[model samples]
Target: MHLQVRIDIQRRRQFIQIATFGVLLIVHQHHTGQADPDDHRLRVFYPRRPKAHRITEHMDRHLIVVSDVIEPEVEHVLSAGLSAFNDQMTGINDRQSLAVTVRNPDTHQVLGGITGRTSLGLLFLDLFYLPESLRGSGLGSRLLNAYEEEGRRRGCRSAVLYTLSFQAPQFYEKHGWQRFGEVPCDPPGTSRVFMSKAL
Candidate 1:
């Protein structure tokens, strides 16, 4: 009985030592921002929640605007989120941007052009612009045709774009792009018209 009691005491001391060590290790990890591999609760209790909150607040307070400032780190984070979402939805996320530029041969100044991307069998025409001087000279048609050809070469089956009602909705229509929908803008007689064309 004495031997058993001594063994019980030793067992209780060992358990207390283990518990104390575990607590110390957890506290050390928490202080150092190092996660304990065996403890999933450490991540939850230590940095993940607070880090997530910080990220949420940072994102909430910031607005992404069209500007000259280039933030590569912020862009990478946003692009990663989009890529992950695209991957989850389609099981494939391949986005390749194509730019067609018209430049003066003598001065090498870029006048205007088209910029777009082909992803998941669809071409997204993000930007298309031409100078007023070059508008009626068939350059726009040539650029549009060249962009669509490149999209087809990249395995895109259809193309999509949006033009303001006051902008080149008629130009797209002239090029066989059919209007799919439109959203009215703030000012009267203006709307964002969505158009699509099959390759």
Candidate 2:
């Protein structure tokens, strides 16, 4: 009976530790939106409380996965898990969002723009789009330059992006981006071009 009581205590402590850490992670992420990064490992942090801890033993537990829908709570679970693991590994957290919006001159409705981020001294260009009306008017270059300039201001030393072969690879090259890698993608003869530039 004593041994059983001890085991119960240990299990309860484990559950409390896990639950407390999970809550801390969620609160941190909620306050500061972050994603996984290598330059800056996908990480999140909360106010100082304790040294980092780890769960070493693997547990066998039944699990159920629900799919085919977006759940904010589900996303928090994923984000917290990843951020915790990455934080444990790197002991560093430095990820930031960087985006530029293009809006209609007349109505001010958003047309398109660049979306990316800076982490660990590197700028990541995630998406860039300009409608047909704005493609060739030198605005694309301005936007690209703006994103890069802000990245530089944020201490990023380089920039990276991927573009489809049919999707303005030349436009990027014209802005001095170099193709470092390529992978065949959908649409015959087309490929995803990975490009990078030194800031």
Candidate 3:
């Protein structure tokens, strides 16, 4: 009888200890920055326009704006169908691609161009360009803003991208992103900087 009584007391003591440890763990997590994983995520939805303005290409001698879907026409021009081959070979790989071209609209003389990509919860600013005539007129700013807005609409909480040292790191910094990491090039010599922004 005494042995059974002692065993019961020991079990009760262990239960109390476990309960106290669980409470302390929860309190410590709350005091720190950790929350329950299930409680930490938020979902947001963006209302869509019944008719979103289709981004179209403007054909001016000095400038043009266009959006390209990887389809028959783009595939034909690249001489590769819209399959694995085209995706691998195209200079720009984006699900939704948009661009502004500075060129002779009639001749389609491409002088300079810009490109952007948007996909599931992410937006990438892949490329930008301007002819000598259009560099200082704030086109780059407009493009960046457009991409951010689009990213928000796509339910993205953040946008990420990279730039080379010779590229526009300072420009992205000015637009409200911070550098998170960098790779100084491929095979030990490419010198690239990575950055990201929260929307």
Query: TM-score of each candidate?
Result: 0.63, 0.64, 0.44
lDDT of 2 by residue, 60-179 (tens): 432243345657988899988987887788886777898898998899999999999887789999999989988889999999999999999988899999999988999989999999
Which lDDT tens digits does candidate 3 get at residues 92-139? 544566554567779978876656766545777677666658666887
Candidate 2 clashing pairs, residues 3+ apart or interchain: 36-42, 37-42
Q: lDDT by residue for model 1 over 1-199, one digit each (tens)?
A: 1111011122112111112222321111133346343433322233332221222222333522333455798789989998999999999877888999999999999999999899999999999999899999999999999999999998999999998999899989888999999999968989999999999
Model 1 regions lying over 4 Å from their true place = 1-71
Question: How displaced is residue 130 in candidate 3, in Å?
Answer: 2.2
Off by over 4 Å in 2: 1-59, 64-66
Model 3 CA deviation exceeding 4 Å by range:
1-95, 100-113, 186-190
The best-first sequence of candidates by TM-score reads 2, 1, 3
Q: What TM-score does candidate 1 reach? A: 0.63
Highest TM-score scorer: 2
Summing lDDT over every window of 10 consecutive residues in candidate 2, give the lowest-scoring window: 1-10
Model 1 per-residue lDDT at 165? 93
Q: lDDT scores for all predictions?
A: 0.72, 0.71, 0.57
The TM-score of candidate 2 is 0.64
